[model samples]
Target: MSKRIFITGIGVISAIGKNASETLSSIKTASSGVGEIQYLQTVHKGKFPLCEVKYDNTQLCELANIDPKTRITRTSLLGIIAAQEAWRSAGSPVLGDGRTGVFSGNTVGGMDKTEHFYADFMQDAQSGDIKTMLSHECAESTERIADSLGATGMVSTISTACSSAANTIMLGARMIKHGLLDRAIVGGVDALTKFTVNGFNVLQILDEEYSQPFDENRRGLNLGEGAGFIVLEAEGIAKEEHILAELVGYANSNDAFHQTASSPDGTGAFLAMKGALDVAQIEPSQIDYINVHGTGTPNNDLSEGFAMQRLFGENIPKFSSTKAFTGHTLGASGGVEAVLSVLALQNKIIYPNLRFKTPIAALGGKMIPETALLENQDLTYILSNSFGFGGNTSSLVFKAYK
Candidate 1:
């Protein structure tokens, strides 16, 4: 028997706020987390803006109640903190016995630490502590989180650039549907570092000001750092506890058209959305709101917009991009937006697409941006899109569990 997947609990920490409550409050108020750099010490201090988490490493340790003396990377620290919140919110259920697992997604696992170590190593090979580099691998944070949570079964990590977190949740649901596990903790985490900032700047896609997703005069994107997590359980387990929402459908597709940029037609995105709708056995008109993968970049917005036009025709659902509030969080964007999507589903609210001025002309005027926040609307299904580097595109369908 195929079991349905349900989100039982959620936890998040981002530049807007430290926990889920704070995140929701920020969304309701339409607060923008993008601003001047604070915690990260980088040479491009005044050149670029970012949505940095307020707490430094020491503060995060205090917040997570971990020993300050323990050496850990920021990525692991952020993931651990968010995962703990999710676990606690889910009643801190016993997770071992091969019935539960932890799946995490991240792009820069320990590059923040490795960059520091590399600098020291360049000065002197023996100057940097080799132990700090031990966590450099992409799987390191996932292992650390699973260890902290005492999850002994099927711990894994997904590193598919920006879509990593969404893929992790997809994998977790697949596991439960196949009866490989009864429950899973899934999400993604990324902390800002000089490596990503400089890399994106090289690409000339890092906007110095607040990103304006879907805006006609959109410049580029603002890089941000944060973690978002949700606890997924089978139908039976969720019925015994409190169920938040249902993960009715998910699908992923790759354009294979470009290494970094999406196809102008958004073929991958269209396929992913169509496949997800198929999985849920729903039609285009059934989706009440869409959390778009609007990165504010010229290529991304244009591509995603075109895809929406192709899929929904002239009667598209009301859609908005929350990245304007949280910044483009790279790997963590999907997970953070997933949490926001859940909030919209449960509360029957659609957040405004902040800073949007005009729609893309290529969409042929089929798009009507949701600028003002709307509440008290009866919502049945909401679709969330996440597209990443290497043309990896993913879409998830969330339904209100009435």
Candidate 2:
């Protein structure tokens, strides 16, 4: 029989709050996690607003069930913590032999430690940079997370910039539908590092103040980091445990326009949304809430706004971006946002698009940029978008289990 996939559980560790419930609470209050960089010591600490996780490395290690002396990078440690949440939330299931697997997305894997090791190695080539820092490569985090979760089958990671985790979830659903595996743990994770901080600054797209997405005066993105994961199980398996949230539709498309910028009209974004709707066999009007990939970047907001207008026309469903709460977790953002959307489905909450004062003149204020929709009423289907660097775009549809 053809299998259907469901999000059984979610675990998240973000800057806004450590756990999913806390993150949700912060979102409800529209609490901005933006502040001076507190976790890492950097020269630009107070010059710009960045969302830094409050925990120290020791705290993160304990959460991940790892030894602080092991020297795992922040990226891999973040994945472990969130993946543990996903595994625990699934009743801590011990799958009977090879029925389970894992797929994750991440870009900065163990980079924090790798950079340090590299710097040390440069000073003295005899330094054992490969000891704890060997798995600093992006794929290493995925391998380590799979090991921690005991997922022996088809454990892998995808690194397509920002859309990494969104596509990870999409791939997991497809694998189940094709009988590749019965159940899969899928998500993404990223941790803050000085490398990313300096990189964004070089692009000159980062905001020195709070990030204002979908707002005309918005400066740029505020880099935040965290880990988020979701357990995707075959319908028959998850329904037995009442751990199912139907992953009805999803799609991914590349803009092929720019290395880091979106197309002028969000052509790739449009393709992804349309593809997701088609997969769900639903029309545009049928969508209830949309969790947009609003990065607050000038190019992203303008392009995404244009795409929304072209697709749903006048009746754009209530939509918002959760970046204000967690900031952008890079590869983990998609997984984190996906879990949030499922929460929105289960709770019928439409999170606000924080800092949205004025809409772009081009899109005609199409999005419902308000924080009040989250606590409104019943919701049916939600469309979530995750657009990444390199013109990669992905969208997923989560429907309340009936």
Candidate 3:
């Protein structure tokens, strides 16, 4: 039997604030969280803007309830922080009769601690702890998060560059709709490290200034680090409890155009958005808001703008990228931005697209600037898009819960 999917709870820890409440406040004020790196040690510490979490490793461990001596990866710590809030917010579901699962997405998994200790182990094979005790594999993050929540049904991680988490959420919804699981926890995490920093720098895509997605002056993306999670419950289970919203539609497609760059026409992106609309059974005109995967890279902005033009044209819904507020969190970016999308639908608040001065000449449309929280227009449905490297593209449709 086909099942309905609804989001019962959401939890987030971004550079803007510690939890969802603070992030909403920061968004309302149009303030920024991007600044010089403070917590993580990187050679580009002060050279580029970054969205770093406020808590140190110790503080995170305390909140996650992990032993101080246990060496959990930075990404795992982030997942734990977000999962705690999400499960708690979901009224901490009771699993006497229903099956529950967890799906997490991560790209740079456990690299922070691994890089920190790699040389130490290599240099002194006989001197100290091998430090291979931590789950350095990408799937390890998903396992740790699932075990933390006692989610014993199913668990996995997706690592399609940036679209990983969005795809994870999409999969969870499918599992429920297909009656595979009654409830699922879906999100992602990635920590800032020298590896990613230098990788982007080497690709010549790291923006020195605040990332301006869909802006003409967009230089590149500012790398960020954080985590976010959402509790997706079957409709029957969700109606049993009052919650935030619903998962209406989602889609994924690969352009297969280029490895690191999207097709000039954004074919894969357009397909994902169109597929989401199809799943929602919603016409493009019904969408109230759009949370774009605006990475601020010249190629992404142009390609995404072109896709938007093709999708919604002049009547495009209100949309913005939260990246300017919380630098690109890479693997965590999808889930982090998904939480932001649900916020807009639930609060009727449209976060300003920071740093947008002029619309791209390619799209030739007036960009939606930062707007104050408007009165809720009875928002019924929302479309959130996430695209990644390797031509991976995905979109989610979150509907307002009854």
Candidate 4:
């Protein structure tokens, strides 16, 4: 039998909150971090709403305990901050013993800094700071995070669009089960950049106001930036008292339906969710709650809703999308949502899908998401979905540690 994987520690820095405690507090009050653009220097500042981490690069460096003069990208800083928190939370395990690994997922990966470099270099070939381009690869942030934690084992980075972080977590669990490592620090991070913001704008999928996920009048997604990390250990390796939740099942699938849109029938989403359930050896009805990848886009919500209907039939469990709270964190969405899912299992609270109004009419208006916070209930099995562009979809089943 394969060893079970348990989540011992979690850390997140998003618009909703900087860490787990703050994130839980915001969930309790149904507060949303989606607001006016403040930190990102973008042309559509006043027009588009973004969920930023509410800190400048210098402040973030201070929080990450790194020297401000160090040439680092915002992505690396965010990853270091969250990864360190997760490491310390896991009792500061002795790393670099070749038994610990780091797996991170990200898409933009230092493009924020590269955008600045290219602009200046275009004007005067030697005008831009060459050092800014050092951390330009997706693996750079992952390497910096691994170095910060002193991990010398297998280190890898996944960049499968929005499903990146979920895949990383799945890979960590598989590695542990396969005896490749005893433990792993897994998550993802992405910093806001002009390139991403303008790219989404050109696609006409960015909502000017707060996103209304699962609602009939949903416009589109609001882009955001942040990082989230979790420490995973084999069942025998993690202390019982520190175990937060068990990663019971996980799976990844692709529909190849479109380059950026999910298939109307949600074939990829259904396959991913079903495969996870099969891995967990549980029925669809066993899922107590679902953290749907409701990106607030019409195509995404409709496709995801149909997928849930196909899997759960008429008895779909209570579900909601926290993206309305943090906006869509792009590559970090899975990691951020995974952290939230673990917290939900531990606390037995379901976060409300903020700003939800009407259900989709196509689903016969029956697919209403949990709009209000539900507290003090039995929540044993929870499923978190992360569907990304190019039809890449992933799901994770997290069960409360009995």
Model 4 scores worst on lDDT over the 10 consecutive residues at 15-24
Residue by residue across 242-354, what tens digits does model 1's lDDT show? 68889999999998899999999999999999999999889999999999999989999899988898999987899999888888888888889888888898888999988
Q: Which sections of candidate 1 miss by over 4 Å?
A: none
The positional error of residue 38 in candidate 2, measured at the CA in angstroms, is 0.7
**In model 3, what lDDT does residue 15 have?**
89
Name the better of 2 and 4 by TM-score. Answer: 4
Model 1: per-residue Cα lDDT at residue 198: 91
Worst 10 residues of 1 by lDDT: 359-368
Backbone atom clashes (below 3 Å) for every candidate: 0, 1, 1, 0
What residue pairs clash in candidate 4, if any at all? Answer: none
Q: Against the true structure, candidate 3 has what lDDT?
A: 0.85
Model 4, span 123-242: residue lDDT tens: 999899998888888999999999988899999999999999999999999999999999999999999999999999999999999999999999999998999999999989998888
* Cα-based TM-score, every candidate: 0.98, 0.96, 0.96, 0.99
Instruction: Please give, for residues 1-402, the per-residue lDDT of candidate 2 as tens digits.
Output: 566778888888888888888888888777778888887878897899788878888988887779888757788788888888888887887754677878889877777877777887888888855685677778888888887877778887899988999999999999989888888888898877788889889998898888888887888999988888898888777855656478989999999999999999999999999999999889999998888888888989899988998898888888888887778878899999988988888787788887778877767754557655447558888998999888999999988886
Report how far off residue 212 is in candidate 1 (Å).
0.6
Off by over 4 Å in 3: 95-98, 124-128, 369-377
Error of 3 at 97 (Å): 6.1
lDDT of 2 at 197: 86
Order by lDDT, highest first? 4, 1, 3, 2
Cα-based lDDT for every prediction: 0.89, 0.84, 0.85, 0.93
Top lDDT hit: 4
